[model samples]
Target chain A: MNGSAYGKAEGMKATLIHGTHDIRVSSDVPDPVIRDDTDAIVRVLRSCICGSDLWPYNSADDNPQGDRIGHEFLGVIEEVGSGVRNRTAGQLVAPFVWADNTCDFCAQGLQTSCRHGGGWGSDGTDGGQGEAVRVPFADGTLVPMPGEPDDALLASMLTLSDVFSTGHHAAVSARVRRGDTVAVVGDGAVGLCAVLAAKRLGAERIILLGRHTDRTDLGREFGATDVVAERGDEAVEKVRELTGGDGVDAALECVGYVEAIRTAIEVTKDGRLVGRVGVSQYSDIPLGVGEFMRNVGVHGGVAPARAYIEELLPDVLEGRIQPGRVFDRTIGLDEVPDGYRAMNDREALKVLIKP
Target chain B: MNGSAYGKAEGMKATLIHGTHDIRVSSDVPDPVIRDDTDAIVRVLRSCICGSDLWPYNSADDNPQGDRIGHEFLGVIEEVGSGVRNRTAGQLVAPFVWADNTCDFCAQGLQTSCRHGGGWGSDGTDGGQGEAVRVPFADGTLVPMPGEPDDALLASMLTLSDVFSTGHHAAVSARVRRGDTVAVVGDGAVGLCAVLAAKRLGAERIILLGRHTDRTDLGREFGATDVVAERGDEAVEKVRELTGGDGVDAALECVGYVEAIRTAIEVTKDGRLVGRVGVSQYSDIPLGVGEFMRNVGVHGGVAPARAYIEELLPDVLEGRIQPGRVFDRTIGLDEVPDGYRAMNDREALKVLIKP
Candidate 1:
């Protein structure tokens, strides 16, 4: 099948932010072309909008580089450069990032730091919310699916490209030991996934901080033992009350706001940990002298999704876990602009785009 | 011997910082008297200066209430109150701050967060830079020395009160494993002791960042495998170059400044950690997107010295470690003002004061 078989023209339809609050789906966007032997052209199967996508969407600055925007995508390999190894044409792959696995950094499972790596939609590389995308360092970046995934597993597997792995990274970074109590601070898909991760990691209890009833319900399904609807200091007081004033043993700060970070730190007991997967928006998250005296440990940054894929593969493949349900809405490539709008308006928890 | 036998009159000599750059050896300070069962009046044997003490010495404001001024001391118990069960007169002990070890926080080994914990120089509690002091929470806070320490071991044992244990906290917090490569920032006594801690924890290699020949030599004696005598960016580049661009497995941020913290982060490999023991002086330590992308984990805060004393006691008792060597100068209690001056002037690595 050619690109036209998937509703593509001589060009690709991709999402681009024109300016503040402006998103457009245009077919004039050029199709990804392979420039390196280690690159692969993937025919995108599914993609989704991320919370971080909102930052640029709300920024006052207009898009200057006409950058290709989406990052979360899993696709079938349509073409592999001659130098590509460990992957072949027609295989399904979702890379952690566009990283070469051969670099010293990548060998230790930090693909995000790959020497030759470049993220989606940078330096002419197309984004994932398109008909097809070009992925660099394909051999090191792309992890092949264990088997041909059915639609039941497709969305969950696609999450391996970012969100699910990121949630898992929070759990791992917090050192979520078996039988420990965990509190997750955020209501988005990642925070909900963290609730699931804490359950999968054998946490004895999971407390989720969220106000939205719909997302909180999802939190319960994802193994949240309780949900604290209050926020900031009230939320912290509620968690402390629930934990019998000792605070939870571990906390996951999935919201980028400094207030969320502070609540996460406050709700954790002394000598406990707070894992932060959300991109920090503050230059300095105030670590209060009182909290510092408690000896709270803060760890986690970007998820090296490449490192976590293999660890989570069996769970997803064996039908023990289904992270796909995070997508409350799905739309075609032509409807991406609407998808972004629905997400921005909170009418949809997460939007999946099929291209 | 009575309290008066040790040259104690109705008043005893004490070091008081009246204001910035104003330290006095006053003989009018009242002698400590036990007022509670958990309280013990200790005739101080030895005390030492700390880097944290320098913070207010250069500040503009004078200390209100004239808080007794010091926190580190090793002393002989001259008297114990009725409620004290684990302590008695004549026992030599070093209490971590003035923490009541029976509190919920202290029971968990974080004396720094003890519910009833208070530092010296308060209402009636005196500073350690004196002939005698009243210590609260005799049972829980005081850790008795193994025996009457010889002069060769006294200063090292005195260090267990603060700096050595702080360095140990840095190493333990970093989770220093066998065969890992470690780097330590700052050449202060704490940094030198961190090199010792890393060695004691079985790190394969230790790197020290310092430009001081004398301190770097001490660092080498304390187990530094290599010394990168550069500052800021040059030091970071040098460590990376030496590590073959892979960066060290772990780093210790022993300097309180942002520049040192930045250097520690920059010299660490992706997914590695930097354990900080310095009293953070910056409101915000900027973590750039590059380091965040690499997944650099910064873990650590104040040293829970009370919690670590027992764990490190065996090493000190068996003569397996010589942490005392960090003290490069010794003086009588009357010379404490000079001791602080020498330390503030960078003329001494660390100062030990005998009462």
Candidate 2:
């Protein structure tokens, strides 16, 4: 099929943010094109609403004109620019970020901090929740799949673009190892994915801290050995009690809220670590003499999705792990507004966008 | 010889804090005794003042009656209570802290947070800078040396009780590995010791951020490959320049001041860590979006000195490393007041108190 088969004469359909709590799918946005020699245009197959997206959705002020908005997607390459090597047109690919992976930061497994990198929906770059995206640094940013995947595998692959990789980063940052006990703070898609990540890293016991039975039930399927429905100091006490008053060996903070971060820190054993992969909503970390006395430290920040994709891809391909279970609902690009509301209101765990 | 040979009939000379900038050696403090079955009386051989001590000295109000002080010391085991096993009388030993090292915290190498732990000079417990100290958790807290060490070796062993071990904690927490580049902030005794610790960990290049020529000269001798005598933003820029504009793989914050911690954080490479072994003087950590975006993290807190002594002792005993050189002056117990003044005034790098 020709690339234009997915595009309208003058534009393409895409998700745009107009104002607080206002999401819209506009069909007047220009279709993505390979503007740079190192770029590739990908026709998006799947996209999803992220918990982080709700941050701006809840508070950002009005813009008379809308701006493009999503970041996670898996797509098929429709066209490759002249200098794009290694990846070709017609390949199925996932772009972690528009990063030049050859930079020093990327060389150190920190693709998020790449000197020549940027995010989608900025500087006229097309967003993921659209008909197609213009991927920068094509050869360095896009991970091409070996073969076409089925629907289930495709959902799991889409998570490789962000959430699953972020959860894995939390596990890695917390230094979860064999025979360790871990506590994951949050029941969002990221937290559920972290349960699978901890299990993959050989954690002997995994605790899920969430009140929702529906989400907690899925967390159990992902390998959480225990669940605590309490909140605040009560949650701290309950987690400590469960760990025999010693606290878990590691804790993962998947919710960006201040209280969630504090609870994660509290439930971690002395001399251990707390991995905070949540996009922080607070500006300061409460680190005082008490935390210092226990030798507890917080480590994780932005996930280097590009660096982790290759390592996690094999398991997803062989059906050993399915992070896609996070997506409990699916809708077309036109339903992007409802998807955002469903996610923000906690009505849907995660809404998949089949554009 | 009897322990009484080192003590007076009614009391023993001990360093006490009276008011701001006021330190005194009183001959009226009661001699230490085996207060519990887990205790032992150690006849003081050597003790030293720490950087943290100055925090209170700079601001604390008057307490005319005076309170016992000092925390780091090495001595001969004078007497052990019946329950004290593994350690016997007459052995030369170092006490990192009065900790029951068998507790879960100690087992995890977080002796500072041990369930049955307490520092010296509180609740009638004898201070280190005295004729003798009532050592709690004798067998679990004391590390016995193989044989009698000379004056030089004795000073190094004294360092194992705190400063040297604390410095080692900074390097370890920062994940300093072979072939890595490291930056150490501060020019205090602990900072100088950190340079040695980084060298032992096989850091390829070591940068010391300090303005003091005399102290930095010792840092160079202790393995600092480069010295950046700049402060604040200038120091940050200089460190980045030294590391090829990429910053260092690890940065150690040995000074507890806010600016020192911030500098350490700024000079660390993206995705790397800053190990803060400094006794935190600030109440909060400035963790913002920029830090999160770069994936920079801060780890480390109080040093588990007891846990590190065994690993670092062999190197000290074999003469492969000399950490005692940080002590630029030596004094008798009665001169403890002058020792504090000298250190506070920057006239002394460190003062060793021989009782």
Candidate 3:
């Protein structure tokens, strides 16, 4: 040990939940102590609520006690463990919320379901919405920006923590090839981001199924060629007609509802692909095995945030991507419950919480 | 113009269905008149019943009033139109019952869903299980065998028309790469044939989910490395345990039911593929969007029989493949109803109706 580097106890502040929806601001929570040499502490700059957060918020039985919520964030490194050679204190970073990139599945791009790495906000770990968080496998999880980001870009950068990566994963898993027509089955932040991802990936045409004018405008700005205000079967027919009798080549399922999954399947052509990124609350979906046999490919899982953070960081820093725009509202940490309510009521696409 | 060969009024006998389940043995059906000049008329030497025939047989309201059922056969060519130079009269041939194989989709290996090809049995054309059949696109759809076949080999050769091709298609669509662990989710003839196909495709481990001892034994004989008797979640767990908790790399879904589709998803690991060959009666399935995001690929449709018939005929002729052994029972044409009943009751693996 280097004697010159005197020991100083690390400290962090986090939000804790006592029971279902009972979130409390706990400032004196001990800062995360580095367990592995490959860990680092990050001072969260901006964090936001995710759609998955609503699951526990809405379910009284599943989430017995108020649990830590939120999983997306942009942060700055406050301290580093001995083995973490890639990041140092004061460096701005964004880390994938789950997954270590070295796993076999992660290497194959199935990082969301990584076999060895995963962390939920309820696990007593620092949630992304908190002021400070601990990240393990720093080298494989965190990506540093070239420089400090301005306030305007921070929220968008924060979106990369999960939603952007998830949207990208959905598009990739759906096999959105060049010149392909794509349909996005949700209008949430992730769905909006998926529209952008699809455009960035060069889909020849993009169809967004959303009724909200603001979201629809964002979708169009992101390169959506058409918007279907109707939903379910009617939406499917509209997409089919837009493609001149053939269905879209790919579909991004961002809402984990049965109807949305069906819509994704219905709007896609034979031999096409559907990337589903929603956190499914229901276990059973009546997927037509025969219809899928007509050459449809379904793929998507948890977003491997770590695998994409690095690749997307530079783009965000260079202003090539604008994912943060999905955050229609930003508020102080205390207003989180209201943000949650607004999102639940579909009044906001995403809510950014600044602690 | 070839005037001398053009004006002959050649008549052929064919089995026609005038209404739902009303199959008639028509002797004076207009001989398949050559329309494109690339067609050939064959005197049927052998034809067998197919599992798909039961769809119309069992349906109470949806069955077409008049539609041919059989789509598997071997025959001797009696006449060839002007442009049909590939097969001469009296030549023994096996023809794909689908359509002309020159379509773009067919070239891309999706012949079953070909843009220009009509599906076998679904098309109201002459059926294969008859005294004589007219085959269009003779050069592309027909495969000439080595020499005259023995009786046993003829029955086996008849399988090349549909079952074997379908099995091969399922295996291929599942992306059964070399050294992969594979699971067959059905015990039908197609499933048994899939065992052979998986073996031929170099699967390192092949597990068959079945209950019948006879089918299990046949599966083992056809290259099933393991047999799982349990169904549903329990069976999925068994397969995962056998593959060291990772599940199989590829799965063949030959049973078209909700349970079978669920079983296929449950038994595959991340980054694996599932090929579904079963015609699903139910069009909607509850898909676990989150689970699917982990990277399971689903791809399969109707089997492109015409595409594989030619490629498989050589192997069949040389005795390198034994797909025909899947037929556990054989009956005369008049016994077709009993065959249907036995199959519907799950009492027979496959029933080959000889006409």
User: Per-residue lDDT for A225-245 in model 3, tens only?
Assistant: 899999988898889889887
lDDT of each: 0.83, 0.90, 0.76
Ranking by DockQ: 2, 3, 1
Ten-residue stretch with the least lDDT total in model 2 chain A: A1-10
User: How accurate locally is residue B80 in candidate 1, as Cα lDDT from 0 to 100?
Assistant: 81
Off by over 4 Å in 2: A1-9, B1-10, B61-65
Taking all chains together, each candidate's TM-score versus the true structure is: 0.89, 0.93, 0.87
Docking class of 2: medium
Residue A319 of model 3, lDDT score: 84
lDDT of 1 by residue, B1-355 (tens): 2333333457988888878877777888877776666788888998988888887676737765354577788889988877889888898788658787778778877788777887677656788888888787888778988688898687778888899999998898788889989999999999998999999999989999998999999899889999998898899899999899879999998988888888998898888888888888775555545655677767777888888888888888788999999888999978887888899999998898888
Interface root-mean-square deviation, each candidate: 2.2, 1.1, 3.0
DockQ scores of the candidates = 0.47, 0.74, 0.50
Candidate 3 chain A has its poorest 10 consecutive residues by lDDT at A1-10
Q: Work out candidate 3's RMSD over C-alphas.
A: 4.1
Give the better candidate number (1 or 3) by DockQ. Answer: 3
What's the true lDDT of residue A174 in model 2?
A: 93
Off by over 4 Å in 1: A1-13, A16-22, A26-38, A60-65, A79-85, A88-90, A147-150, A288-291, B1-11, B26-34, B60-65, B79-89, B98-108, B122-124
The CA lDDT at A149 in model 1 is 78
Please write out the lDDT profile of model 2 over residues B146-263, one tens digit for every residue. 7889989999999999999999999999999999999999999999999999999999899999999999999999999999999999999999988888899999999987889889
